[model samples]
Target: MTSLASKLTVIVSAAFEEAGLPADLGLVRVSDRPDLAQFQCNGAMAAAKVAKKNPRAVAEEVAGRLKARGEFAKVEIAGPGFINIDLTPEAIAGHLSAMATDARLSVPEMAQGETVVLDYGGPNIAKPMHVGHLRAGIIGDTLRRIMAFAGYKTLGDVHMGDWGTHLGILFNDYIRSGEQDKVLKVDLDDPASVSALFEDMSERYPRASAASKEDEALRAQAQEATLKMQNREAPYYEMWQKVKAVSIVGMERNYGMLNVHFDLWKGEADVHDLIPPMVDDLKARGYAVESEGAIVVPVKRNEDKKEVPPLLLVKRDGAFIYGSTDLATVVERMQLYGPSKIIYVVDQRQGLHFEQVFRAARMGGIAPDAVELTFAGFGTMNGPDGKPFKTRAGGVLKLEDLIAMGVAKATERLNDANLAKDMPETERASIAHKVAVAAIKFADLQNQRQADYVFDIDRMVSFEGKTGPYLLYQAVRIKSLLRKAESSGSETRGFGNTEIQKFGDSDIPLALLLCELPDVFEGALNNYTPHLLCEYAYRLAQTFSSFYNSCHILSEEDEVLRGSRLTLCTLTLAQLELVLSLLGIEVPDRM
Candidate 1:
């Protein structure tokens, strides 16, 4: 079914065409003023500006055309240029009923599906994931789920950082301790503890780095070991593999807790061999040149300006930078999947870095014109003090600790509410875990991805306001009623497939809101923002509350009216679940 806005746009477009004007100006959108109208066409003013006529006159002309059609119950031309529209009650009810039984819920899929490569969950090999990693993983996972639900064949890659100088720093620390043979052995059966190794490196790597600054010989030794590891020397390569295998255990644990997964664990080191060839191709194609003894791919934001420097592919000392690995990764993705779109979810701080990468890729013809490269940048999380979140010790907050903290807060709230006190221990454990994860994920996703949001466990797990727990509570409440209906043998067919020929005064508002889901969903998908879906879900739950409180469903004297209200409850629960899934939020069966 076409959206109401789309249908109105078609009608208005014809009017614009008949008036010998640009039809594009006749786009119809949801009215900003709810008390004024359900929908509005503001094209009159834009068209009037172009046609050199009065906006009110243009609106009157459009209103006359709209009135000739009997779909709308009221067609009013407000002051200046706005045309307010309210669909007939029958129209709204018919659309909503059709949506209830439709498998896809009247949300159309993309016209043609494309192969997509999504890069996210980028935790380096040695370091622990922090709240900063939380933002990228959550946003990228939601986008992946939404795009896949809309029929795109997507590949989620972790894009690990296993091949950088960070490895060398750790290696230097390991070798200087004089336990080289014992540590170099690859224990694939039972990997070494990553946290233990990280602790060791955390203490010693800085000292090694500091001593290397004053000692050129030590620096040279580190560089030599890095080269040997890259060149696949027996001892260094085995140690490298061991480090990679163990580090991934911690990485996967964090991802599993967040319900995030990657189809490919390809790291920067995976494309190491490809970089030399790529650099050679760039030089041959005249897209790269030698600058300060380093091979570089020059990128400029403006043709007349050269503020930002070029991307360094190879350092003078013969080492590949992260940018080089990124370029090789593009070529690798193109060779394997030939995706139409490659989306990167990273920090907004990396805006310039991605710009440099994409431009360099396009200049070198690594990304073809048909391939669309998009970087969805997100803001950082902050503490209540409005600074970047850190531990009391002024260290980075580990993601695992954050999860544990969320669960603790949720459990306290759940106990305080005295909910499910007699439930089995296993069920309560499951609820606590789900609520904790939901609180963390929802708190991050409820705001626009580009805007920094304060991290607060209390607010997130609260049962009131626009919190994840509240949405879950609403769903659980509906389930309780539906169970009650089943026990009483009350017919609920009114909610499944039956169309309403009439509505109570209180039902019209919800019916209208339900009809706008397709438009809201489409907008959210196009804008690459899940917060919009959060908004629709919250407003829907709020409306359902009003409907439940004021109108009697299970206790109504009129059987047909009661069944209709039951159906409304069922549809609300379904839409709420669908949006929550889109946002990657979990709803418990019980509060």
Candidate 2:
């Protein structure tokens, strides 16, 4: 299942060696100028520069050898020594036939056995998730899927922010409000009681958090509560556990709606115990020192062009901060999973924070140099006003509410289009849910992760353009086409047939695009850019649409041509579905 490009590179690389030049100069890529050739190699230009010879002369020598091999239909030197290649129709057909049968769709397992840990979905306990958490959940889930598809063992951690000062504030407020006894006595198994407790805490938490910022006494009490909880003291620790349990119920319900599941439901609490020892090790090893009463890791280096503040691990009051927990989590992950890489899918604004943490981890010897600590930071999802999206009241919109809006919009679109009108109510509901999720996920994933995008449910749920529903519609269209062909007694047996009668105008382009699937996937995975795959999927759908419009399959009298076209359609659908799945999008059988 070697790709056509790889095969050509091998042939052309050998030609470079035969011409008494460096074989590495034979790297071949899909031609940028599709009007001239199917593939191009600019190696002769580089080789000429190194060998001090005319690039055209060098291209001629390599072209002569390539022509002798007879693998390409045409091998000609283009302007200034670019080698443009045209594969024979038979060669294209051969690759397409192989791709039609390969389950991986000719995509190689680039990562093989590498282990990767993805940290995302950082929701705090007692606080409901908001639209701000949307990008992290969708992007991280998609990355995990893509990495897993690339043969990497991936562990996705929701990394809930359960153990933090916010919890301490809630605890202080709960104690003063005399609700601690009720919360303690409530049965954890009773969903209603737990939900009520969580709701009360959620309401009180905002008030307490706001008050702590204004009242020095309440702030000190919260800080003390935090230290006590960290020390596993009395009812505070037990109450913290109860709060965590109730919060998890709501978290699971919300994340479940988005179809974002984490392999590990761990959080700051899981690493709290490791923080003390890690801090001790850092201080003992001279990586951490007291900076104005707080223990900080000085990560600033001489080559730094901008200020790199020291990572504060412990405050003067003896409470550990986020850096301590994050550093400890890294230690725990390395010791537990031994992952070769850990990618943090967080907001781009936290770039400096992660830089300090990564520097401290390496400087403190907490993480080995071989393990990559990367920050896959993303930009904000803005409203039409170019500001962070919020409810009309200027409040942070809940994640559940956002999802509900998408679902409602999707249902309305379905009704307007008169699609799924005859289906069962339950089935229609399921389709709407799928469509909603696809719209939301695709809208977020279609952008470069580091770039900001406006949230437009209306445009995203449309059945036309580069929307998720459009791709779903195209996939459904092909499925319907296949069903009709099957009913007409047109068996899908041409998948293994390599002898295509003749290449139509659109057929070769579709075939050539199919061959680029592996390259697209590799590019996406290597750069952690899902937009590359997004662009490819949209183009593939559009190309297939063109091919379908030009070529009539079921009505064709020529059986071979009809079968060949059907095979192309079938392969296109498989690839389309495959790419969609990698984007964490689910395609319905019909739209």
Candidate 3:
């Protein structure tokens, strides 16, 4: 269905056309003024300015020539020649019922399904997962789900940073310390122990390097050892395998807890060999140049950083940088999937890096408009000290431990609420566990992506205000009401398939509330913001509460009115459940 605003504007424009006025007032938009009416048109004021006539006269003249025609109850002139449209109760009821019967939630399908790739959940090898990774995981997963619901084929890639100098550092540390076996059993989150090991390794590597340099024979032996590890030579190969095994197992546990899965977990190491040919092509196409023995993309440098140097594609030592790896991935995606769009759920700090890559991709003739890039910025979790987030002892926090903390906090609230008091103790605990995870996911996603957010468990797990658990509570409440209605053999009379059926004598408030869903969905889709959906859920919950308080569906004497209202209640619950699902929030049956 065309939205209420879209439908009304079309009718108003038709009236203007019939009155022999200028039909072209450019495009019009529905103004946000609930105090006046449902929809308002401001085109007349602009048209008056263009025609050198008074705005009020133009508005009244347009209104006089307009026929009522049942689309709206009244069209009155409001402030400064704005046309305030009051749609009929029948119109609101009809639109809402149409949404209930339709499966797309009244959202339009794409003209043709498009292929897009979402890069998120970036966990570097040998680095512990932390809250820094949480934002990307949640936001990217939501975006992928949203696009897929809108019928786009989306590939969710983790884009792991599994190859880099850090790997070399870790590998070298393992070799020198002769703790190759311990690498296989290290618990990455025991901050006290892990920090000491990492620091000791870091300190010893440099000292050993200096000593090796002073003794040429020793330096040669160390170089030989590194080569063996790189090429998967006998003993060093076994050691490298052990480190990778520990790291992958740890990352998988985190992903499992987060409910995140990647369509592909290919790392920079997987695509390392593809970089050289891409670099050669960039050179051949004049897109790259040699600078101090390193290959560089010749994009104009940022004037803001006068002292900072240009981006180097390859180091002077002929090692490929992350930029080269990203370039290769972009080319590989274009050639493999031929996607029309690509979204990177990376940080705002990497904005310049992506801009460089996008320009290079365009120059490479991959897809001029074929690649679309979006960088989602995230906030850091700070301790009580208010510095960049760290443990009390000043170590990085692991993601798994943070989630566990959320779960523990959530369990306490659920127990205090006594929501499932009569249920078996074990079952209550399991439900609380899922609810806790949902609360964490919802809290992170309820805000706009660009803003910084504090990870406060107390604020996140509360059952009031704009929160995940609150939304879940509303859903559970609706389910309870519906179950009661069904047990009593209540027959519900759904508003039928007509696009403009009347609501009869039923209170129009519930019908009016239901009509707002299409607007909510439209805003959510176009703005690329899930918070809009959160706002919708909040309003829906409020509307349901208001409906229950003012109108009693179960006790109304008139059977048709009672049946119709019951149906409205049932349909509202379904819509609420669908919306919560869209946001990745799960509602427990018993709350």
Candidate 4:
């Protein structure tokens, strides 16, 4: 399963050591300019500087030494000291054939898998799902699946935002409006009523804030309710449970739509009891101090002597801020899972918050030194205006609205393409929805996680370009060809990869790309960026398209050549599906 570049480097690296130069100097990579060669090693120049010699002279000596290995057809010294190694057809075919029969395509699992606890999908109680939550849910969910596939035991949690002043606002508003009995006595099992109550509260929440701003009595009631809720008063606690229950309805439905789920619905309130002791412990350890009548735990940005604002643990009036609960949750998670790592798949806005929490946890001994904490922050899903996404009337777009928007664009495309015009109405509906979900997820996942991307439904669901639907359509085409081959009584499996030795020239490029799948996956995992995997998928799909257009598969007169092409097609389909599954995209057999 050694990569072509790695094998090339291994043989050449010994030459460097034999020549009394740096041994691991000639690290090779797939060449950017394919017209030149398949791979290039530019490390000789750096090695020359290190050894105080002419770079070209060093490269020539390295090339002379590499020639004994008999792998490269041509190892030419290019610009400065760049050594471009063109793999012999025999070498390329050997690797491709090896990959053809091997599962994992050549990517091996890590020697030691981690027990990871992933914190994501920060859905606030009483609030409906919004576009803001989409990234965390999609990214975290995909990471969980990928981690498991990569042999890590992953535990994904929905960090529900249940303990906050907002809870008090919703409670007081409902109690004052005299609709308390309807929520308590009515069909609590009805999702509609729960959703309706949540939606109504969401709408009135801002009004409640505005009213309380000028009204002292209302403000007092809200604060009192918050204190009571935290203190476990029967009324506030009971209403709080309803708040969480109703919110789960929306959370589950929206997350399910995106194929996102959580191992635990552990919210802020779950760690409430721990917060008091945790804050006191920090205070006892002198990590926490009183400042301006509030308790705060100051955290440093680094080992350097610079300092940022401290994380406020509690206000003067005894109501806790988010920081306290976050620190407590860290303690609780460590106690429960004893995980190797806890990755927080949050957006970039909370970058400072997490840094502070992690630091505070470590500073206060809440999180152990053995446990690794990572904040996998992503960018926002913005609208065309370059701000956070919104609807036609400039209101914040909900998750359901985004889904509907995607489906509509997909439906419009299906109509324009006249695709599946003969299909049943129900069948068309199902296909369009799958396309929509796939399109939306792919569009977001393709972008670098920390860079904001505009959400454009029309561009995403289009069957052309690098959209998800295009990939799905490509996969479908491969399935169709394979099915046709099988139906014609053509032998599909048991084709020896010996035929791969005959593929050269135009087909060589595709073969080379296919063999690099393992390296591409390793690079993606190393960086914690699925966009790397997305890039690999797009390139593979594009290369396979070129191969399909040039080399006929099912229609080829020669059975051996046809079988080789079919094998390539099957391998491409498997790897494409693997990459898509990692990015949380799905492919249907039919377009």
> Using TM-score as the measure, which candidate wins?
2
Q: TM-score for every candidate vs. truth?
A: 0.93, 0.95, 0.85, 0.94
Ranking by lDDT: 2, 4, 1, 3
Lowest lDDT sum, 10 consecutive residues, model 2, at 492-501
C-alpha RMSD between model 2 and the true structure: 2.1
Task: Report, for every candidate in turn, its global Cα lDDT versus the true structure.
Answer: 0.80, 0.87, 0.68, 0.81
Per-residue error (Å), model 1, residue 237: 1.8
Q: Candidate 1 vs candidate 3: which has greater lDDT?
A: 1
Question: Candidate 2, 86: how far from true, in Å?
Answer: 1.4
lDDT of 4 by residue, 401-498 (tens): 77887788777776776567877777777778888888878777888988988977567556568877778878878888888877887774424343
The CA-based lDDT of model 1 is what?
0.80
* Superior candidate under lDDT, 2 versus 3: 2
RMSD of 4: 2.3
Give RMSD to native, each candidate.
2.4, 2.1, 5.0, 2.3
Instruction: Per model, state how many residue pairs clash.
Output: 1, 0, 0, 0
Question: What residue pairs are clashing in model 2?
Answer: none
RMSD of 3: 5.0
Candidate 2 lDDT by residue in tens digits, 1-591:
567888789999999998899999999999999999999999999997899999999999999999986468999998989999999887888888788778898998887678999998899988877888888988898889999999999999999997889988988888888778766776789988987887787667788999999999999999999989888997899998888888888889888888887999999999988998998899999999998999999999999999999999999998989999999999999999999999999999999999999999999887889998989999988888888877678777787877788788878777776666787878788888888888787778889999988876466555457888878888989999988887877764443353455566669999899899988898889888998999999999999988888877778777777778887888899999999999888888887
